[model samples]
Target: MKNEIIIFSGIEPGKKGAGNLVYFFLDRLKINYVEFKLHFNKTPDGFLIRQLKNFVPRNLSKSLYYSFYRFFFKSSENIINRKVILFHPQSIGLELSINLIRNNFVYIYVFDNFLFCRKSYNYIDRNKSCLLCLKDKDAYLKYKCDFFPVKHNPHKYDDFLLTISNNLSRVHFLTQNRNQSNLLYQKFGPIPNLTQIGMMVDMEDVVFNGKKTVKKYDFLYHNTLIEAKGIFYFLSIAKLLRNYSFIVPFSLKEVRNLIPDFEDFENVDFLSIKWNTGLKEILINCQVVINPSLWSAPVEGALLKSIKFNGCVAVVTTEYSFQSEIPSNVVIKLPDNLVEASKILNDVIDSEKIRINYKNEAKKWFDLYSKDIDISFDKFIQEEFN
Candidate 1:
């Protein structure tokens, strides 16, 4: 008999990355499930009710609006039989929803600690030095990180926790920074039945043709052009490497305008490529890929993609601990300072051996990781639910 699983995430169905992975895994397993796009508003007529509440008398209108909202917005009691429900990014509101649908089916929560920390929002606003969420009562709430421990209270919501890394499981996997695994272990007691599953990528359509030197540009930087992503820092490095060709993909024109004394260096070109088309083609052509994220570790998929294309990675050591063994060709643990990062990247370009080694290493690693994902999914279902 096929087991039915319902996986729910806070994000919309097809934005990118984790959400995309979730969809891919479910499809691969051929699991019978429904993907529901969660609505954040507490009421259907919330917008109209709030507008009317502002003009009408406070006491009577507020009571009437809330009563109407609750009657219409409250979740129904229909529960799926012999099914397992998995919730990503623990939230008090989500836990409450699960309780309303509770039956004999198992409920599991996937933990990604970075989602709970303030540093997660480092890329959001460059001008703002720190993340501060005035809405939440917790001191660490400022970053707009969504995880809430209150949702995990046993008496209220008893659900199994599946962490992303073994090191994280030891510390209850509170942050995305793998380096802080020990720190978390010190804070929280040891976790039980924890598993380490690296980030998943859909490779069915990914065409790999050994390594080819297609020098469309000397260097490329993909991802949002925001502060924490180190876009400004990358621009400065491009200025220093005056002779080398640099490509900045999908950066807003306004971001370039913000930099003072930023000249249009002849070799540097800013290309407005949509992520779906231009970005992929650029990755395929570039000789090197540079990622200088100030916050959050390197996503496994991003790092793996760079390696697959036989490109070197220049990223902050603090963010991505370089925990998993990497191809020596793929450079990790670069200086947090942009000048140092630029120097290292330049030196690697000069070293032919380094480039060759990385290409070979990346292919080997991808093969090892690319083993049938369906097998893992089947194992997870049997072990966890059965």
Candidate 2:
């Protein structure tokens, strides 16, 4: 029989990290496959349904979404004995994940720590990186780290994680970061099927025009709105170097809410730009791209894109686990300490030669890492049958 594949994820293509990853991978995969993108709007649309959706709770909406997709997939003909690939299945809901495993051999690609974490980012109380949830079953409940709008029922969340752990043998697990894999192993003893697939970035998506972009901004903070990703730290660095121009491509109101007095800084410009188009322009023109993630972030998409630009210097935290993935020679590593990190950034900004030298040397490593990801994916596809 010819090999058939079924891919599942929550978001539509060309969107968030997981969505974009799914989109890019599918474009590259030369095979016969079917994709099920389970979104909130996948529900039936009508005058009554439209009015009801506004009042429907997020948790209830999730349950209905997953249940519908599960029934559709289960009832579909010619689905037997085909390989199932799940990308960010946590967003599809716990019931569907369990159901998929029961019927088919599944491969679960984990971009974040959603299986064991309530918030999925492993960032607790907006403070720092933590793995307490792995050891203490009640840690997520204690911290009130639920990302979804679910009720305060500890057992409800625990059941989701326990299901994954119990069925480890049935579903193959994959992660980009080594530390994430270690943490998973720590919690589940040892998952024989677990694989550490290296980091990946679509080189074609990051391709720049041969003509150089004129340098417009001295610094750029285009990371996620989440505080744990280091908006506060970026604010501190901007404050320290008030004269340097900073561009933040995010909504004015949202950025203001996160940083109450963000508007007070005259040097920083917050322009709400679309991810695929406008943001790419800003990335090419910017001199430095700041991605000081406070948590053990699996190599961020922003960081990966920033490093591609030879003129742009990517400044990231040395403390986080993602730092171990990239070679030190490519990007500039800033310390975790707030005061010390700010000083180093200030010094780097003052010296134009330092920026030019670092930018010039990053391309070789970028080419090598790009090749590694391609090789990793090739291996992952071949091992799926084994």
Candidate 3:
């Protein structure tokens, strides 16, 4: 029998903001496969039960979610001896993916830091980027890096690493960037089965018309409204550059909740809308799109989309481990210091020649990335066929 591939992820492909590499490859390859997604909840919980969960400690509630996922997850024995490709699975789903390693040829696509860090974002204390957990297993709890305010288990990292190490022989890991793959090896030792596949961008989703229009906003911060994603840094920059017009996909109240000390800036326009075609238009129309994430983000979607579709220059935080492969001229990288970063952004905004140069380099960089993705896909397909 042909080795049918089982594609498993947290959700179904082709959903909103779900046009990821796996989705792209599946459509292009047309490989014989069946799909599986973790059901959030097969049956609705009682209102009181849901309320009780809210009252429960965040760590315990997180445990509950995993238990619920496992309870609803019905894995078929037919998957034995088959090929399974896990694409950006949730923590619980990742655990399940590890378990499948013994019985099947498992290919795990790493998008987040779930394997090393329990919090998975690889960020700490709101403003700092971290990767200490990769080498020192105690770093997660020692640094109090839980996503929620609740205390985390001390041995969570230890146990998670043990599980992954045990299943290493039967698994193949695919990282989105070469730098990400290198970081894994530098921290976790040499991993022979790891492959670096550049992130896939669907051209159909890109909103680039031939005509160039006037920029309505001076700066755009369309990332999630979270501190680790550098919303605070963006705020700081906004505070510094009060004269420059800024736009975000969040309300003033929502922004205030994250940065309680946030001021009501008249120059900042908040558009609370779903990230659809409308948001794409806004992104392309903006003079600059900032992705100041305080983490070793491996080719962020926001930054990639902005570079691929937007007419303006993309600005990002300098993450040596993540952005090492990205061309220096393609995107403007700012230092960790808010003041220094603000100065760089100011320079970019003021100089039309610099913006044009960055945009030109960005086109070359994106073309290289696209070619890498195509080559990676071809190699992956050849391996799968074999």
Q: What is the C-alpha RMSD of each candidate to the true structure, in Å?
A: 9.5, 4.9, 4.8
* lDDT of every model, 2 decimals: 0.49, 0.66, 0.66
Clashing pairs in 3: none
Per-model TM values vs. the true structure: 0.64, 0.82, 0.83
Candidate 1 lDDT by residue in tens digits, 1-386: 34444443443333355455555545644562433333222321357766775575433454455344333443353444534344343332334344433442433333333333433333344312222322232545344443222223332222322222222322222122243343334333464433333445554444433434354887787555546566776777888888788888754454544464556777777766644545666776676777665553434455555656544555554433343334444454466566777787787667867766666666776676556334555565556545
Instruction: For residues 1-386, write the lDDT of model 2, one tens digit per residue.
Output: 34556666654555665556766666546542433322221333446544544567434555455455545543234444557777765555556656677667778887777666666677763336777877886776677676542222356456666676777777788777787777778878878798777666554665444444365888888688777777877877778788899877786766775567664588887777655546777777666778777777786777777777644455554333676566665677876666777677677777888887767767777777778877777677665643
Q: Pick the candidate with the highest TM-score.
A: 3
The whole-model C-alpha lDDT of candidate 1 against the native structure comes to 0.49
Ranking by lDDT: 3, 2, 1
Worst 10 residues of 3 by lDDT: 35-44
